[model samples]
Target: METSPSLAGPFALGTFSSGAGPAFPGLVAGGRVLDLSAHAPTTRALLERWDDVLPLLREAAAAPAGEWRPVAELRVHAPVEPRQIFQSGANYRTHVIDLAVAHEPAGGRPAEQVRAEVAAMMDRRAAEDQPYVFIGLPSSVTGPYDDVVIPSWCTKPDWELELAAVIGRPAFRINPDKALEHVAAYTIANDVTAREVVFRRDMPEIGTDWLRAKNAPTFTPLGPYLVPAAFLDPGELRVTLKLNGEVMQDESTKDMIFGVARLVSYVSQTVELLPGDLVLTGSPAGNGLHHGRLLRDGDVMEGTITGLGTQRNRCRDER
Candidate 1:
């Protein structure tokens, strides 16, 4: 059975609605949703003043249920529409090593040696090298339960379930030790990809083409709920994903080659992270590529990160 964060006392926040009504920022508690837009218009607005708004939200969540609606009656949207999204690549020790072994270079080296070398490189990188970061379009983000449209041209659509950190304060050139303080919340993000397009074949010198491979509309399914950073430990959570009732990815944040603090601080060195910016920590091992299975039309993905809710997205072909 799938287990999620306790929703007993209104600990998470989200954007939800009933029927065709507009989305509203809501407090999630005990399978019910309390609209919080009257207190703070949008999720971004509340995040801008996260420190101040948290107290107010807590008070409202504790108040007697007055306008609360059953969760089943609402449609959940991505909790926040970030101004910018920074995603980490090749940031999981085992995941990258798995890819390296699967696609061994022409060099005459044993597979075991390659794995050992790659693992050593990751250790050194964790201690010295900066995290590999890339940009993603906010327009690619869709609601947690939305459908993913696989473009007719894409033959290798893949799933990469990751933990995304939501920034609550502006951070620039901050050190790793202080980076976590700027994060207000954490949510689930599936970094869906077009495997065949990740690298530029014709322009190999230019390296990756992330924009084409990762930024398709509805490529990123974000947030059934946003759990506050203070409420959970980022490094200890377990991330699990199931495809049509079969487990595909099951790992822990403990396996991350570069943890959240390092990624956030490293990115802040180049980009100014705003209140609503998102930093997607890399996905763990057990992706479809390793399993030799790729997403197809009618496939359903259910991804869950401990303390954050699950995201269920059905894949469809773009006509």
Candidate 2:
């Protein structure tokens, strides 16, 4: 089906409203939102019937700008309420190498050699090993511009800006070659982490404790908009994050050792991926850990991914 000529370029999909009232699916264009509730009540509803709903959105976007609402007057939501969220860890080559070098500085070898060895290991993993995937609670998700509450009991809250892929269709054990076919769209996600809680010091044999380290209320700041996968070249996009207006994490998806298609297929090997499920490709290098700057109360984080839009979230201390 031919897309509406009016919706020519990369338009954003989201839910918005003038106040605290019910949110409606919207097509964002030129700082204005064209309500799509008449077509689909929620972004999840639109993704469920993505093929049919897309054409209608295009037509609606082509309509005259009479009913469009100024975005500044509206409240934006998390875009979609995902049923399941699959997150990738240690996916970016440089990010992992940095962590490795930081954790275990070379004893005799030059740092360059250590970096090279780690990179080689990543290459081997990409070729033979599976991607490390973790399940995240959907309850952790919040709107893009929402405030992040740093728990008082927690220290070393960190930021991991990642690219999230929203699944459009159901797939079970899909091959890597066809995995991207099921991706409906992409969004920006800040995978906030509690550094101190990542590992259980008392129970060394238990490995990672992602539940306490990652899943806190409003921990994942998702979406200023959802840019359809058809409109994005994930490999070409740059992911960047700024703390209090200073650049922290800034890198291109090109640096990822395992690409989106591979991550999706790798996870689908053990789990069924359904529509509205989010697959968060790992964060790029320059996380707070690398810079020696963890999140503090009252800090503001602004994250931007090329063509996907920007997200600004303030950090507040939990009461």
Candidate 3:
């Protein structure tokens, strides 16, 4: 039996298209997909009317009396075309500590010493009550099962699987207590990175160059489906990723220094989050940097978060 967790709700939402047809919003339930093109058109439009559609979804899932098709018949896509992507960095305590310890110069200090220093620094960051968030272009996003093309210049390709919260309501400067109210659904996103170009060699003052380091075609592989926020809890979920069938990242959301609510609240203070915006909480422990095994050409990565579904992507060279 397939062991993947089912959607917490009776149905999930997705984008799909058949041969020679335009893509449409779909409601997935029990191996079947109900085309939602007539109701709200695209997935983004559906999310805009999420409050009204949510009740309709609950009612549809109870009986599924419409013209439902098998999920296997259509081509699945990265569920939503997000207008804005807010990515959190160093949000997970263990992931930060592990990276710091691994990247430390070998002869400089003991491994334990490096870990302790990093741990203390992370604690200070958490106590300060701010999250490090960055902006990402929507053009970098690709289908969940699509191929990731590792550019030739990227000698150190890495994977960071994260829990993505999709925004339903427009929010700006919202409090942490009200942040969850703006979240409509949850999905999966793999923030693939080219580690070498992350820091610019020419300019020390300019800091990170996210444009060249991260934004490449097919670098960000996103969701297979969107599970409603009402059905799942962002906290206490398990995030796991396997490379060539070997487990690399397996950790829980509990280790996050800044949970979903705090991260969302922090981001809203700076920008107005619109419908279909994505908030990507940082990855947990066990990334390629710590494993000492960067991605090779043709490598396959399968990532999963509890009740959100699994995303499997194959790597390809940009030749």
* Clashes by residue pair, model 1: none
**Highest TM-score against the true fold, candidate:** 3
Model 3 alpha-carbon drift over 4 Å, by segment: 1-5
* Per-residue lDDT of model 3, residues 199-219, tens digit only: 787996988888877789888
Q: What are the TM-scores, per candidate, against the unseen true structure?
A: 0.95, 0.93, 0.97
lDDT of each: 0.88, 0.86, 0.90
Provide the clashing-pair count of each candidate structure: 0, 0, 0
What is candidate 3's TM-score against the reference? 0.97
Residues 1-319, model 2: lDDT tens digits: 0011122254779877665589898898767788778767789988998878777667766777558877888888888999999999999999998876765644766777779999998989888867888999999999988899999878989999999999988878999999999898998899999988988989989888999999999999998888888887999988989999999999999998889999999889998988889999999999887888899989999998888878889999996
Candidate 2's C-alpha runs over 4 A off are 1-10, 105-117
Q: How far is candidate 2 from the true structure (C-alpha RMSD, Å)?
A: 4.0
Off by over 4 Å in 1: 1-10, 105-109
- RMSD of candidates 1 onward, in order: 2.3, 4.0, 1.8
